[model samples]
Target chain A: MVSLSDVPLTKDRFQTARAAHLWLVLLLVSVSVTSLAVGASGTSLWGAFAKILSGQSLSQMEKVVLWDIRAPRLLLGISVGAALAVAGAVMQGLFRNPLADPGLVGVSAGAGLGAISAIVLGSTLPIGIVALAGNALIPVAAFFGGWLSTIVLYRVATRGGRTSVATMLLAGIALGALAGALSGILVYIADDRQLRDLTFWGLGSLAGATWGKVAVAAPIILLSILGAFTLGRGLNGLALGEVTAHHIGIPVQRMKNLSILVVAAATGAAVAVSGGIGFIGIVVPHLLRLWTGPDHRTLLINAALLGASLLLLADVISRVIIAPAELPIGIVTAVLGAPVFLWILLRRRGMVDL
Target chain B: MLIANDITVQLGHRTILSNVNFNAQPGTVTAIVGPNGSGKTTLLRALSGDVDYSGQVLLNGCDTRQLKSWELAAERAVLPQASTLAFPFTVIEVVRIGLQSGTSGETDSVAMQALNLVGLPHYANRFFQELSGGEQQRVQLARVLAQVWDPVLDGTPRWLLLDEPVASLDIGHQLQIMDIARNFAHAGGGVITVMHDLNLTALYADSVAVLAHGSVLAHDSPMQVMTDAILSKAYECSVKVNTPPPSGFTYLLPHSAGLATVSQDSL
Candidate 1:
């Protein structure tokens, strides 16, 4: 029989948590450097470092390739990765279930529908609205779509102040089906060019990332990530259940509202910019929970770092595997993350009821 | 002092508690006892400000509904009947959740002390889910105990509102937990527990409130309230009260209806 006294002490756990965070940070930096170097242009990371260290100027083409094309894509990948991961962590905490994710909650489907609608119907819409949205129209529409679905799902799942996780999961599946149906109708009507755009967006890619798109997405993602940090304590209290959390002086209702809003914003922005990147949101937080336990304070931060690094590493693989032609980032993440997720489930087979 | 005055709780269309008046003074253990489905838990929940009710709950003369969330947390801590945690939280981490109200002190020391008081000093490091049911209940009790570790704060006594705190504990741990409650009351804190064990209630609670069908049937000292007539009527069984030689404590032994009919036939 396993006894209570066999567990590790608080001091030791804290030390391990700190060490885990430090390692993730170090890994992120190394992966980030590799991400900046590995591209079709063949600008070596060490060569760039040497040039910058010696105060020497790079050729115009090298400067353009490194600073303009690669930098924006890397930044976008980092932002989108961190956003999705943090959104996943917050969603899991809010629902009080490890299996909850943005995709499971229909945010990705809603965003996909929004992007597809924009791709297929933008020219036919009122010129005033198109002009107003300008170059950021697709991302804006996707954000609104994700946010609206979240609100609808939240309203449907919650009755008289209590949010039921089971109901939310069921409702999310229904909503996803509805959104997928709408997206299919839009895809069916699209011309060949529009069809290609829809296929690429559905698969998710950072190849289209530019400084302007990054600029449009960065603020919403950053603010929501910042907002998630304040929720750690409330989420911790909520682990005991809602009534207990309320008894412990957490404003449970307000916390729930804020958590939902932040998750929606972060996920909406990420899906808007990078399209529906899978696995990072769900898998990163689950893996970290295993290593550091389920303390959300550390979990959120580590998820962000690990999520960013993993996406960057995946982006590098997407870039180099086919050289001039890149694989869609969503496919790369799914290819890499699916096996690891399966391993996690297999290892914890009997322990989790899921 | 904690006073719940004329409280009535309605869950949907069903009225769970009606016009129930109860009070617990500082440095006293007040037990609320009833049969299953007799509104014991509901009344306790209303008193703890965890449910919507029609009447007023005042803690130290301040209406509980008027108090802010953190303010109420500072004044009292509640040990719910059952807590389900999704993640594998260590015992100490679970206890520290009680400190999230920003109560100041050495959190680790306070959590350890509460764990020690519950006779699980070495269990601080264990995963709460890994513990047995009774042990989980004690860990929850420790969480609440750590929340209001100080008996008296700013000249106002703190309160512990427990619901079926010992329902899952074995005899030894039950006594240990009851002693912990008794010690808290002895140290000038107040405790209002919903209990089913009549003998334990008689032994530990200074006062007993017998509730039936959403109303307070009787509220008085244990000896006054634990009479044979009241116990038999409230519990729907024949009960005999026994007084041992030296202790002068009350004990109630319930006779089942089936056994009573058999014995009556034999006689």
Candidate 2:
């Protein structure tokens, strides 16, 4: 039996989430600074900033190392990291499962296939197409590829407005294998120089990050992230299921369409630049949801912050752990993320009925 | 007034609700009662715009098709038979989700007040998934209650469209929920619920719509709709309706219960 008692109601987690926002911003800034300062060239960010603040010219070594190399890599890292994490959070919300990551669900693999096709087959394309694409051919193709795969996965996994976790993951495996086989064929046909590029790119790295790649990836990633922010309320409503969401005034169909497009563009741009970096999407959002409540209004933004910081930190480890030669950032993330994924599965095994 | 004219819901070749014309006014507890697969829930869904039915549903004198979803939300709140949350949310947070679209005057304490009305104010901080089935149902009812907190706003009545709102509760809690629905209607709100318990429906409903084979078999006062002939025909069983002394409200006992008692007496 329940009694009607006058107990003080606990407020929603908005304040705590807001306070955490402040801390996450601070953490991202510090991680960004640390990433800039810790590369192999050892360009001291403090010296560069201090000199710029005092109106002094940068040394030639500092200028080349900091501006030409590390700066673009850092920006790319932040964009890709935020894109992956935010995409993960949005995908989980859309699918209504905590384990639904874009990378794990073959979106990144589809994008990877698109990027490899561009790299291996770009020279054979007509001059007009090449001229039209300029530097963005890879990212644009990857966007379509990722978009196609997301739609396929969504259609295959969801029926009658209900998503089955088992079907989604299994479909992801099939899609990943299909993408991998196609990428392998492209790798087999590559010329000697393209082969060298494909070997490193397939492993996933921030090593080849350049100003040109950053210019192509950053805008698409940022735009998609902005689109994802508008989906917080809709996603929250969707957490109660589609019918209930519509009853609460959310445009369920439009929001779901926007979510699919946002995820594809973000993931396509990221995979075009950074290869198949896995686990940041799954790990960052899962951690944030555990830290605060699973309120997407805060969760999406916090996921961006933590994703940026975590990826930058991983990039730092990749650079320093091997010194002159670096481990692929993908290797670092998988080593760290796969265990967390397993732990989450085990913890939720009895609770979620998944 | 809520009106559904020529509401026909067809799933594949089978028609779920066929040309059903039903109307409910403000300030009344209207119950939709039927046997299994009799389209009770489908009629509710059609009226709430959750299903695609070839009919026009008018809520408060406006065509539902022309009204935006938010406009419809402001006019009514729906309670599905069961609600499952993908992510963990506290009880109050879930309630406030309704308040986001609701045109409530006192927004701050209405969620808590709704919880209190459902007698679960103390569970405000508990995780929704952690609650029992009945408790979770009440929490959803509280959320629906918070959506249309005021029965009538600006002289126009709001609606609480519930599907099997008390199907999961025990006897006492079923009474408590029926009382809440009754109170909501008494305060000038319209309550239309799909109910399984005919006795509870007879006790609480001002009007009852009886459905059999995807058609409204009867729609009138509970006394008219809850008769033995209608019950026996609709349910395909012999139901003996009784007007117990002092209260005189109709209660039903399946005629098979008497036969089972006779066999037990011989044994």
Candidate 3:
């Protein structure tokens, strides 16, 4: 019953896109500054900046806290946030559905299962892998686990060059449950040391983020993000449907394959490092879509920036809310994101069939 | 020119179109008409290269399958029966999707002109999902029109392969759409439409192909094919084709089996 005339066509879409980009960039800078400033210790960002600018030598503790700890954690937070949001945007475009999310597709659970196995069974792993991984075994295993689950999910959902979104969703749910059960068994067998590691990782936090982890994760995340940006036009064509997308000169099958690969690489790298931060993948792109009119060209870029900002803001709150003891970043995102998601659903109640 | 020879489409064990030979020449409107299950849409799909068939489909004397997807897109545009979009895209954004193929500069202006041709010039910025069914159909038609806005490019005529383009439209919009198709043909482009309204087909189509049971029953001028026996046999019902002496326009009147008894009881 919605009337076409009632929807105004006054805004210039390009101008709106430009404005959204600018606003999100500013917001990201401000929130990142805030994230680096506020932490367990009361080191003001200005104090760190002033100390560096004045050519004064900082104490070993101050250098360790600022350069070694906060900087890397902030960098990891931004990379993981941007990766999850971009993956979500690409997955939504590939599935041609607004509700599609990286977590819903079993990527997070697979990563969790991989991380748990690495934690509980590290001693049994081969000597070569242990030497190569050194301290980074957990994230590397998690990345491979995520990639494996995605390959399985994609194979189960695709047949004769067509991917059924419904089948993908159902199979993802089943796979997630299976991964969760395996992770539970691993947790049951773990000693006290491994038990603590599993508990903290299960809750999802950036407390363990380090420069070494960022070095391992940033390249894959950045490459996948760049690859995803190139798919904007093809995804736009796909919004019309597969046949029309083909008619409009998009290589439909190739686009689908590339989208799936990009999403897996990006989300796998992110979950490997961040330990399954929740809701940013689903919430950031959906929220931006309401403002940007669902054009993937602009939506993908804005989602990256805004996703980074929101996750940093959430990280800041998680650090400060409990002071010396940090709350899990996943819990913070769910608390902040769940209500916004419900509001979106309620606003679109009559328009879309859930 | 678009040509299909011995096109046979089999979905699993059932054949949807069997050895269906069809030709659509440049500068002409060809209508494919049939009953509900007569495979008119399937025949159009085969001609558009949207389905795999056993026979050859030639576009401008080249085998259609040999052409790359972008090359085929540059030559023809298809308006499907229905398109469902999951996102809330603006009308112009949907139409701009057509600009993905060839070097069509000034995409916004081209899309606007296509929308103007469909009599919805002001709908460029509106959300596509908010439109009514008929409006949505027009938006799709506009998208198709935008794809082949230039009826002829470098002396080669483009084609519009439309499947039930006017199915959801009212009478006024139906004529408007038919006129749009006719104008494209007059401008030296090919138009092949699957139609159910025989009267509209008679008025607008340069030639008519009547299909029944996955086979072509008749293919000729409307005057030659719109006959009592041919239609009645194809439709499996009593039909009368009438033409007045001066106007020379055909009107078809179908007789319902139980109408006489119902009318008598009411009287």
Candidate 4:
């Protein structure tokens, strides 16, 4: 199927395996510094490095910029990017549709509505009341909203007890439309600031990444990400078609459910932290597949790496594009991701499906 | 042992398989043949736990319905009529999936041996989806061959349920598959394959199940089921059978008055 360069390096080819592993590790290693240092703020790379290494209390301005702002935002970008990429890769496996997205599966939209409802209802409740309501209100609403759409989609898509791509896609489309309409109606009743906030959040930004946001996102992202890496074998079995998957003792139904739950929750958590970032879920697995083939073990980890790198780079570009104000991360990804996606598509016209 | 007792399949308001009964002991090939829409794949899918059906399938004295997913997989493996994998995997990688729930699954030597059985050992490293239809079929066979397991307990029996596995292969490959199926049965593994080729059935099938309109019209040896009256009725074609000069199997021919009855293909 491929020439010399196209032939995938096998695991036994220790040199080739080492080369690819080293390259991906290098990519991952390379981006950790970029995430920490590249930003629009006053914390220079040397300053942040010196502050941490020197073990000295920073000036008030430096402390505020580093801890309160840049640190959390960078962490959020990497986490959310990783979450979307992993969720997207999972969805691609779940439905065997390369084009499926975390949002299209209704996870993102449901979580968006849930978090927005919390924000909208927060104004009416006092600070004294907010503490009582916020803890129970936010994640519950998000989980319930996301889970409801997922359950409905699963039922409609699975016919005579088997899940098919055509049915999954159709059901996803129907539920997505219903969620979009309900979200629009919610936005209709909002006040001026709430309206602006909803619009801006829907366009998506990592602007609200505080320590509190990380506190909420960290555990969910970590657990789902771990589960994804562990379940790589089951996902690869599934891509072989359901009968073969079941014949291989894969517990196809259980794997399907696990995939949906893990993806929806991870996507919901990411949406809760960083609003609705679009296109990342739809494209990352595809690019990952191009780079590493469809073996899920490599695809899952590579997805996390490339996704983090892609979004971190997108964040950097967003910051520098407008000197004083940053563009929405969603806009930046679409502008950048679209060209790469189209380039892949155009170059492969009538040549390869991926 | 494999048993399907009065299996009935209903889709929507219509019945697809109506009270079909069949069973097979170890070391036998129970060839299931039927016209299109006669529920061959449906029956095979039911056997592999791919569908919810009424009635019972017992394997090695255990009810299949009660078996866990992994248990059923280890005991009975089914090759559907056609499997076109949507993902990109090397032929070896695809075969390795057959070891999902089996012991000795990680041994590439065993997998390569299985591929060698099907004359595809050299293609083990080739991309599965890159192969032609015929090659892919052989590769899938190798996958199943790698999946041989001890799920029948320390001394229990193993079974293979295949649905039209050689539908795309050429004549020589088809004969090789027939031989392989025969070998599996002769070695005390139950082999049930759905085949459309009557000549192939005559050549290799130890027993044949003629399914017509969701019901078994006949269940007997190929010599009994391939009679001119039943063949003409089931296949809707005129046919003639010719005995070999020595003692080979009968060869089928088109029924025509001008051709000599003894000439198998003179028509």
- Candidate 1 on B97-209: residue-level lDDT in tens? 87963224578789878887887878877889889989999999999999999999888999999998999999998999999999999999999999999999999999999
Residues A1-354, candidate 2, lDDT per residue (tens digit)?
356555554555766787889999999999988988997777799999999999999999999899889999999999999999999999899889887878777888899888888889999999999999987887777777787888898899877765555687799889988998999999999999999877777778888788999988999999999999999988989899889988988878778879878988899888888888889999999888878888898999999999999999999999999888899999999999899989988888899635
Better candidate number, 1 or 4, judged by TM-score: 1
TM-scores, all models, native as reference: 0.95, 0.93, 0.94, 0.89
Off by over 4 Å in 3: A1-9, B101-105, B257-267
- lDDT per residue for candidate 3 within B154-187, as digits (tens), equals 9999999999999999999999999999999999
lDDT of 3 at B88: 85
After superposition, which runs of candidate 1 have C-alpha atoms over 4 Å from their true positions?
A1-11, A45-56, B101-105, B258-267
For all candidates in order, the CA lDDT equals 0.88, 0.88, 0.87, 0.76
Candidate 1's docking class is medium
lDDT of 4 by residue, A1-354 (tens): 223344344553222333555676677656766756666664676785687799976777777777787778777788888889999999888777676787876767777777677767767767887776564455556656776777778888886567776787777777878888887787878889988877777878887778877777878888888888876878878777877888878888778878888887788888877777877886888876666677776788877777877787787778778956889888999898788778767865664434
TM-score of 1: 0.95
Top-DockQ candidate index: 2
Please list all clashing residue pairs in model 1, or write none if there are none.
Answer: none
Best prediction by TM-score: 1
What tens-digit string does per-residue lDDT give for candidate 3 at A91-114? 989888887887888887887788
State the lDDT at B2 in candidate 1: 88
